[model samples]
Target: MKSALIILALSFIATFSNAQKKVLPVTNVTTGKEIYAKHCMTCHQVDGVGAQNMIPPLIKTDYVLGDKKRLIKIILNGLKGDLDVNGDMYSGEMPSQALLKDDEIAAALTYVRKSFGNSASAVTIKDVRRVRAANKTISK
Candidate 1:
């Protein structure tokens, strides 16, 4: 009976382990570009040059290549108030993209980071999840 119980436990563990494992989608530059074109390109522009005296450019900006957590939060929670980018000031209201799925946000951010003449690591779904969870706690 003990041996049977042990076998059952092992099977449960194996099943749980397999259930916990997830295969994330491969990061596609084309998908990212498409997402950007659909959602971001309007403001940031295809060149990511942004509008002068209004939208801040994403090119090589510290905000883009800086702390991953803050960047993710900005995407999830949106941004307001004064922002200085490369000696210019922008006070535009960046609405929350929290409605976007985690993968979509990651892809868009990854595209932004890797493109616009900026070379940075891709933003993963894990990164987005962590920030979203933390933001929830902070808001509550």
Candidate 2:
């Protein structure tokens, strides 16, 4: 009986420890939401409608709906100059969030891609890490 109890206790402890392990808590959607809140919300607004012609809306925009890779690159590297969004030209520089950790960037991008009526595959930390490493090489 004592041996059985000991085994049970060990199993419980193992289970608890496993549960506590930190392994990218945020899903792509959640990560995107977090990123939006932390970074994009100020300009894009909580409802995804930007300030008239200033920021440009994230909801149902061609920029968000089109080209996944381009979107990913934009998030990873930032956008600049003039760009067309739903028939309007948005001319501004989106500063690089290069300082953000790879996972964070991935989470944010994932959230953005999945949120605001945009649906796409989740962005993995690995994907962000790869892009960051590539950019680092180019910048150097």
RMSD of each: 6.0, 3.5
**Candidate 1: C-alpha lDDT:** 0.89
What TM-score would each prediction reach against the true structure? 0.81, 0.74
Worst 10 residues of 1 by lDDT: 19-28
Q: Where in model 2 is the C-alpha error above 4 Å?
A: 1-20, 23-25
Q: Candidate 2 lDDT, tens digit per residue, 20-92?
A: 8655345456666777799878888986878776788887776676765566677768889888888888897
Report the C-alpha lDDT of model 1 over 1-140, residue by residue, as the tens digit. Answer: 99999999999999888777645553567778988898888998998999999889999998999999999898888899999999898998898889988888889899999998999999998999889998999886
What local lDDT score does residue 13 receive in model 1, on the 0 to 100 scale? Answer: 97
The collision pairs in model 2 are 32-111, 32-112
Where does candidate 1 stray beyond 4 Å?
1-26
Candidate 1, 65: how far from true, in Å? 0.7
